[model samples]
Target chain A: MPVAKILRLPLRLAVHACSGLVEPLRALARHRSLFLLLLRRDLADRTSGTVLGFSWLLVQPALQMLAFWFLLELVLQVRFPGRIGFLDYFLVGMLPWLLISEAVMRSTAVLNDLSSLYSRMAFPIVLLPLLPLVMAGAIFGMVYIVLVGLLAGPLAALYAPLIIAALLLWLLPLAYLLSVVGLFVRDFRQFLPFVLTMFMYLTPFLYMPQMLPEAMQPFMVLNPLADILAVVHHLILGLPVTAGNWIRPWLLWLVLLGPAWVIFYRAQPHMREAL
Target chain B: MSVIALRGVGKTYVHYEHVLDRLREVVTGRRCHREHVALHPLDLAVEAGEVVGVVGLNGAGKSTLLKLLANTLQPSMGRLEVRGRVSALLELGAGFHPEMSGRDNVYLSGAVMGLTREQVDALYDSIVDFAGIADFMGEPVKNYSSGMFVRLAFSVATCVTPDVLIVDEALSVGDGIFARKSFDRIMQFKQAGKTIFFCSHSLYQVEALCDRAVWIHEGRVREDGPASVVVAAYNGFLGTPGGAGAIVPADAGAGAAAVTHADPVAADGAVQPAPGAITARLLKVEVEVDGVVGRRLQLTTHRSNLAVRIRFVSDAASPVPTVAVALTGTDGRMITSAGSLNDQRQLLRDTNGVTEVTLSFPRLALLKGRYAVNIYLLCERGIHCYEEAAQIAEIEVSQEGLEQGVVSLPHEWAGSVES
Candidate 1:
């Protein structure tokens, strides 16, 4: 009976616990050149001879900030007077969301793009997904610098550094996970774009959770990106940092990731066969 | 010690000769197809450090023996044991990625051969030098020509230094200089005392490299012996006499030979031989694999051991003629064929006498396990046969799993690949 009980428990809890300790150590020990190779290949395919390779990373969130400013200020005439003006407040919110989306999109084709690599030889599937995930964060880091340096007012200096750093730390594991899931399911390529669309509207990306439809508020606050995005807004805009934001997403992340990691554990055998 | 052992190996494949048979199975309540047995039951063994060459007509189970050893296919019956690590090149360079560079492919190739990352890393520099790809290790393999790809793959494969190496006809390791290098490497491996098992149609190569050989006809082994014996048998069948013209060897001691043996009187009122030397010889011998007579030869395998059987009819008339027979491949390569007519010095006395000789093997030694034996009859001047059979006897080898070599040559060779 005890054995049965243990069997009934999710395997994700064990796999994630091990992965948490092992992953960071492994990443640090890897050759720098391999990581550089992965990053370079991805960048070359995406930006070959384009007008702006690095700028594309910066411009997306900046464009969102511009859209929000016009929509809230001119169309609806809404107001949230604070240490920073409306446009600056929006940029702070948009940056982290942009990073999260980029991470998800990069992972969508993690397996499909590597199908040729798979048939040709045996590959360490565990390490490969990390490439796209790390590159996502790297692109985010590049964009984050220009904003904080060129545009962040003196108040922006105080909390922006600490808040964005914390957000990125949480994202590494999430991005790695999504990459693997996208690889296993055939529907992910088509279904994910729609899921991303839904996840965005459900989170407080456009408006505060208080202003959201009441019944949806709990799910909205529990969104993994929501609490982190709120922390970023609070740090840059000087909103009350004690709102019911931080604890909920952190708890939800821990719960969801435990089960997700188990699914990844089960997927390795099938992945090798298909690859 | 036996390096390879087998017990009761067999294979049966049901084929639907007509398209309708396949379609009916999918839709009908019952399946309708005829079962075709490719290989029959066989039991055999190979000692460690022995080089064995397999010879048979096409479909005589040559490749099947190699495939079974490599664990590529599960035997229908019996068990096989291959001691130590066996590296198989059933298909040369099967897993090279076009987009990955040659250096990257070394790791990839090693993994397919069951080498780990760290192991390949330790041997990386050596593998690169062996492939002679120092100048092109960084470029994507797709850009490399077929010759370059083979060089890189062969380099990585040979560098691993496996305990047992199983090679198909992939011996044309590369072009020109690379081919020469590859040939030297194979010979080097042979000198190292590593066990080498190979199958090739080049009799000269097989004779040169293999000490032992096996001949397979219609999926069964006909003979296993020294390369010399097998090669001669294969050649005999190839140049066999054809058409309806018959060879009737002469009798040398029609009256005098018989008188000395105590049965001095002839049965057909012919004179008996006196005491002393009574020299008689076989004028010619002919054999066919499957077709009856005067039909076109349709051979399936090209192994050196298994071919058509020949029958001899001796006579003591004429000039006491000598007789011979042989088997050969469609590409001028010999399987299992041999006889003595012109090579022998003795001549027959009675030219009107007729006798019959039949050639046969234990089991068909082919993988697809099929071949047509060619029957040839030759005298001092011309050829002969009954009605001229295309393929002699349609034989099939039962593969229950005990079969060891593809052609099951009687003899075996010993050597190692360059480490």
Candidate 2:
């Protein structure tokens, strides 16, 4: 093969990733009012007719956390061997997990569900995949801060916004990839919830990492989400975490970014016709 | 420079047997589906302020061309550029959410049209006023009547006049009064020197409103030029047998001729409708010229009296069907056609759901040539075809004097000859 041809794939991948990351932000800036209207409409659609309206976002997660606290702390009276209490660990881990799972699950079907909005008009469909991330981010980001403040002091709570922002950025590539997959392969959306449930079990959200069987413990490094939670625990709870924990998720993100973005950009022309 | 231009742009829809085949093609970089060419590659350009009208039978790919220019559907091949702001009423209320309030839908539609919040705010009052549904703006659109919905949709579409306006059959919106109001609004847009592109079935409106007309036949530009000439050609084509090939009744299945049954059977040997099958159907059509009854007749231009008798069977459950007859020259140009719908006369039928209508013309003025007669049974609205029997009879006309045109014009010259 010629040298230029050999370099062409990587060159195009690099170009796509660079443009993909910036194009959405540019589209957002250009269509700020339209984006805001859609966001408002999305939020309203979820909470319309409810007495609490938008506050349900905060209340729903808080209620789930309370149920978990009741089961672990009050009912079972479980204790962890580490410096972190079982209740605090589960609470902190569960919030981020909720945010990630909600965003990912919704992202898969967002394009298909809202195809009517852009199908017959000249619309910026790229804005749709980002909606789930933004909505889920706002809901959990507020609750994460309050939970951290209640457990570890206000000083530790300051990292909540940064952590949520980082998680959203990490999810960006996955959101774009899964959206295209879900639209083209409709069966993927029907099976996504089970996959997410299995992922939740694979990650150490409900129990300590040390509680895993010896053989399975070694493979925890393979899951980037495990690495992500480890980093989150290290930040807010000051738990011991290795440098690899910090490097793994970011490395995975960088590796998948180019392909995911190129896939999404290439699929855009077909999106109008997909539905 | 042309405000709107297309260079060999066309659309081909690839139909996969299953949706996953599309993904397979993307992954494997191989063809996996059948290709339907909705439009062939064609070139076109329009000046900055031209009112261009598109006319074609249903399914003639007129909507495909408009959608491509409106930036809704991406063309499968070639380059298309439409400069300046382009607003399309391709479908009225297409952006509306039935669950949303009318007020919110207005803003939503405005946003979809790329209007900023402040721009929408400036135009909100005029839009609401024009639609005249201020009292119902708070309610959900699902609760609104069809008229109210179209009124609001049409109002929002036209309130913000863009450089190029694309409309599809939106001129005849709402009731008679609102239709006139919408027509006046379109006239205002034309007077403002904005480029307008619209497709409508009413050829009279197309001739009156458009400076240029494009007649698209089977996804190709069959004719493109001055409005009157192209419309006349299209109108002439509509009178031919093959012109109605693309038009199938809404409830019709499979083929175009399936709607018309050949002849119904009756126990007493009389023409009667088939039970449980209630579509309006043609029974018999007879043409007579100068006291002679036959399928073919010979007549003189100034002495022939032509008459046509048509019998049809219709269901009492459906509205009375209208009768139309056409006379066409050998070249398929419709010399003239008349319908009872245009006369606004109700056709009476017996208790057996059968009616016979005869149309007569005294002193036939056709100069010379063979002419074919066509009969049609249409729905009460006169738009939908219930049944059609094209070229059922033929007439040959002979003229004594040298007249050059298709018909003889009644004239008397008062000027003295310079001898």
What is the per-residue lDDT of model 1 for residues B201-256, given as tens digits with 9 covering 90 to 100? 65545765788887765667777889889867865554455211111112211111
Interface RMSD of each: 6.5, 1.3
lDDT of 2 by residue, A1-275 (tens): 79888889778777777776788778888888888878877877888779999889888998888898888899999999857898889888899999999999999999988887888888888888888999899999999988899999999999999999999999999999999998888899889889889889999878878899998988999998899999888899998798999998988887778888889988998888888
TM-score per prediction, in order, is: 0.53, 0.77
Candidate 1 DockQ vs. native: 0.08
Q: Write the per-residue lDDT of candidate 1 for residues A164-204, one digit (tens) a residue.
A: 55665565556556766676555666787887888777666
Instruction: Write model 2 residue lDDT over B24-122, tens digit each, in one string.
Output: 898999999999888899899999889999999888889999999999999999999999999888878877877778888899889888898899999
Taking all chains together, the TM-score of candidate 2 against the true structure is 0.77
RMSD of each: 18.4, 9.6
Candidate 2, residue B40: CA error in Å? 0.6
Q: Which candidate tops DockQ?
A: 2
Model 1 regions more than 4 Å off:
A2-16, A19-36, A44-83, A153-180, A210-216, A242-244, B1-142, B153-169, B186-334, B337-419
DockQ of each: 0.08, 0.52
